[model samples]
Target: MRVPRSAAVWMACCMALALAGCGADKVEASGTTDENGACVLTIGTLGPLAGPAADFGLSMKGTADLAAAEVNQQGGLRVGERTCHVRVSAYDTGYTSAGAANGAGEFIGQGIRFVIGPMGATEVTGMKPLAGRNDMLLVANGFGRDALQPQYPLVFHVAPGPSVWAAPIIAEARKHFSFNKVTIVATSDQSGSDIADVNEIRFTQAGLPVSRESYQRGTQDFAPIVSRILGHDPDLVDLASTPAADAGTMVKQLRQAGYTGTFCRLGGESTAEIARVAGGNDVLGNFFYYSMVDLSDPRMQHLSAEYEQIAGRPATSLTLGWLPAARALLRAISAAGTTTDTQAVAARLRQDPLEDPDLGRGVWTGQQEFGVDQEMSFPFYMGYIRDGQPQPLVRLEATQP
Candidate 1:
């Protein structure tokens, strides 16, 4: 027998309450009706707006703003019998733990109920308490596995978690090139280490031998790390979830070292920025990343044009997922018929999968990994870069293994 979506959501919530020891009543959404009787919903964007990761924060904020504008232009979202408009408030967290706390504080102060991002491990953990306290629904694009529990049930992850991405990335590697052995170069931080560890396990599971190396986060000179990675003389070099600048620098140094092997960045975003930093496409040789989207689709083309018109530049992979996240939140709110009940929105999200325009079909299910069911699983796009130009190849469906 087919189970009802509401029944599934109710069971998930009950399990969360029992396991997370978190009170659903602690935080409350504070949406208000304007004098015009239209529901006014405020959403927040928390990320690095001032530091080295500012580009990522700005792109997230810009894409979110565009999504809101598009919704408002369409006469607003339907919330029960009324129409609702969205207001996006962005905070510059400097990509630090303290900044994340401060941004969360600001959101709480303004009674913001929905948030887009605050990428990275440290920042997401820092914002968890505030998110829980404020009863806000946070849709983050970072590594949220460690922070996800019944305690922070409001927090949702849009990116692939743990074992999910490994199979597809490995399969793509073998298909794109004849790569059997791999070497990993990741930042020596909690986030990078977690990703690298997962990659190691997944590669091993896929019957591929892997070697791993790490460098400090701010190391601009990647020669030392690149030298160590190349020492393995592996057929593939995995830049495991490195930031844009660092990954680009590593790519440049690897090319200069005459390492003509395949280059793969598991968390691929901001390809144009990486290409520019790597001193052009010639240096970015035989690159493979897992974050490409079909921009040629009319819906995507329209979104991209709108984003470029608003952001004052072209949209890259980094900006692609924000719209889907925003749309999903709206979808949840409409389904729940109320924005004040954050859990209701989350419940609706878990039960009903959305046809995401950018990320393809997506569903929320993480019962096996995280104790809670909040991770959004989707078929991510894979791309191939030859000489410098990236071409979107096909959708890679994640596997259970």
Candidate 2:
């Protein structure tokens, strides 16, 4: 598929900016001073801007850009004595390990101290070592079991994976749907396998027998996989960690194959896109998925409004999920009063309360899973599709560590 024109333009701009200082090895000023002599802090956003997962990457980048614009609109972030303007530098990682590592390297050359993403497991795995060596902080997104560890203190998770929220989400689904067995479909990569492993455990613990099926990344056809899944006679099909595009295609194929079972996705937020690709709500029939935000909340609505105003486009569901993390990073930088001292910034990040006027209060979790309390826990919702129409979302309270 061809890359969207808007995405292509954004990618060109970001690559040009990232490569401008490729020869610089020393840590220079995080940003250049404006004509008024105020600091300009440039933060990087790393993710795929073109590919099956581009929706996720673009959403993350857009949110980070929106966060920076919000600060700039308010006269910039106050770091001690200097008023620093936030500038976002985005790089399209193409959902590849090499692409991610290369993007991080360019950011390092440009003296970027912080990054908002590198969403894929492969991307995170590729970027972490470089980020650690450079003392660059990452508010990253990845579902791999080992995505976060105490050894990598500078890397903080944007949200918990299935290990933290899967059980509750599964239990909630059980209240409305009756499913005796489940078939989990995911990619064969670590990103897919890791999340599938977590969801398998959750489903089994909930008394549902489970089976697993995986496809290689970039597979457009789901016929063979759907055939294997139907062999299990599953009452519920869990799209665990599959990209939204792939999941939607699978949904369409499964429905065409006369499978009238319920569908659930315990991964990323892309329900609207999924529905569109699946041929609409009727094709989805009975569906449930994790919603990163309660859109009905007035504050969340305000966030979407602000994003549209600044970005000149509507925010994707996944875009809203990234705002709290981006906001947290900027707030931490402000509190630390130094863009260069990442250790101090990281310390302040952990100390600051996980509160956002638009996102409400959250908590720092992940100790039980990642052995570090660095994952931000926030209130999420379960979106339900009943008989080809959307229903009111059920809000779940935020979890504690």
Candidate 3:
């Protein structure tokens, strides 16, 4: 990925921090004052820059760059009497705990108190301790929020956690189908289990009997799993907490198994990718995927075009949310008047909800959910796969338990 103008200079600084052995003390200012005497606030991105999850990380990085560029285009951020120009610095997490911790340590040493990603659940959880230890504010775009948020108070889940969207999805699903029983097929991971648990509760609460099946990551053969799940005669199959590839595979294999049942992915990205992998949209024509943005919205169309121009590819459902989260983070810093005081910025984030241009109005609040006021609450979008395309269904208001 090409580094954004805001992040063009951080390569050497990142190398220096790595070479210095990640000292405990914070490093010097990441950027110098410009001719206007404006301070430059450096926001870092710690995510997978290489390997299998590269696309996910790069998409986030690219969109965040767009957000930063947009902020900079608006005369930068106003902080007290002077302005603070924003610069983004990206570090690769390699989709490993050690890598995530190392990258986070380097960011902490370099005085990056605010960051945008550690996109997947593994990396998000891996970097949590480091974030709390350094008092960094991470607006995460991953799952496992119900478990991690209570443990890592500084990490705010900006993306819709599995449970966060369960109520609305269940209610909507009830309206479309006559299902007395549902089956959940999820990856056997912390996030998957947590999502399944939540979905089970929601489905049961909705008067639907629910059964769950778990698959280890990288498992290719879904024939048996699909058969086993279908054996229970579930009217609805919830691909809860599945990654895009896995969800696509299950959809294809399940449909081939002649199981004409309703399908809904609880937490995943890119229905187009799923449809492509599933061989046709008809396989997933009834499939509904949780979305963070309403793609049909004019603002989204404009941003999508702009993002495509900058990224050289069309943005996916997951990619769109990061820009809004970045915008919210920057706005909070501006409101707090300092990027260094994470508490003040967090307080501001709680005080004033950010009206994301794409996702609509939302706030950073976890008080009701995680016992901490950190997670972002926003409208959840439901997208349906129709003839090889993702179509917007409804924008459900954010619900709190």
Which number leads on lDDT?
Answer: 2
Task: List model 2 lDDT by residue over 1-401, tens digit each.
Answer: 33323223333332343344321223223446768877999989999888778898889899898778777766677665677888989999988889899999999999888999888788899999999999999999998888998999999998878777788888888888888989999999888988899899898888889999999999977899999999999989999889888999999999999999999999777888888889999999999989888777776676777778778888876788777788778777766667798887797788756765566688889889888899998887888888888888888878862
- Residue-level lDDT of model 3, residues 124-158, one tens digit each, is 77788888888998887666645346666567666
Ranking the candidates on TM-score from highest down gives: 2, 1, 3
**Model 1, residue 129: what's the lDDT?**
87
User: What do the candidate models score in CA lDDT, each in turn?
Assistant: 0.71, 0.82, 0.70
Candidate 1 lDDT tens digits, 1-401: 33323223333433343344322233333367788876898778988776446667887787677767666666666565567788888998877778888898888887777888877777888888878878888888666347467778888875555457666767766776788889988777766777787778888988989898999867756778888988899878887777777877888888888888888877545666677878887788788776646666665676677678666877766676556666667766766667678878887666555556456676665656667767766666666787567666667774343
List, in order, the clash count of every candidate structure: 0, 0, 0
Off by over 4 Å in 3: 1-38, 49-55, 94-96, 145-151, 386-392
- Candidate 2, residue 348: how far the Cα is off, in Å: 0.1
- Model 1 TM-score, all chains together: 0.85
| Angstrom error at residue 88, model 3 | 2.3
TM-scores, one per candidate:
0.85, 0.91, 0.83
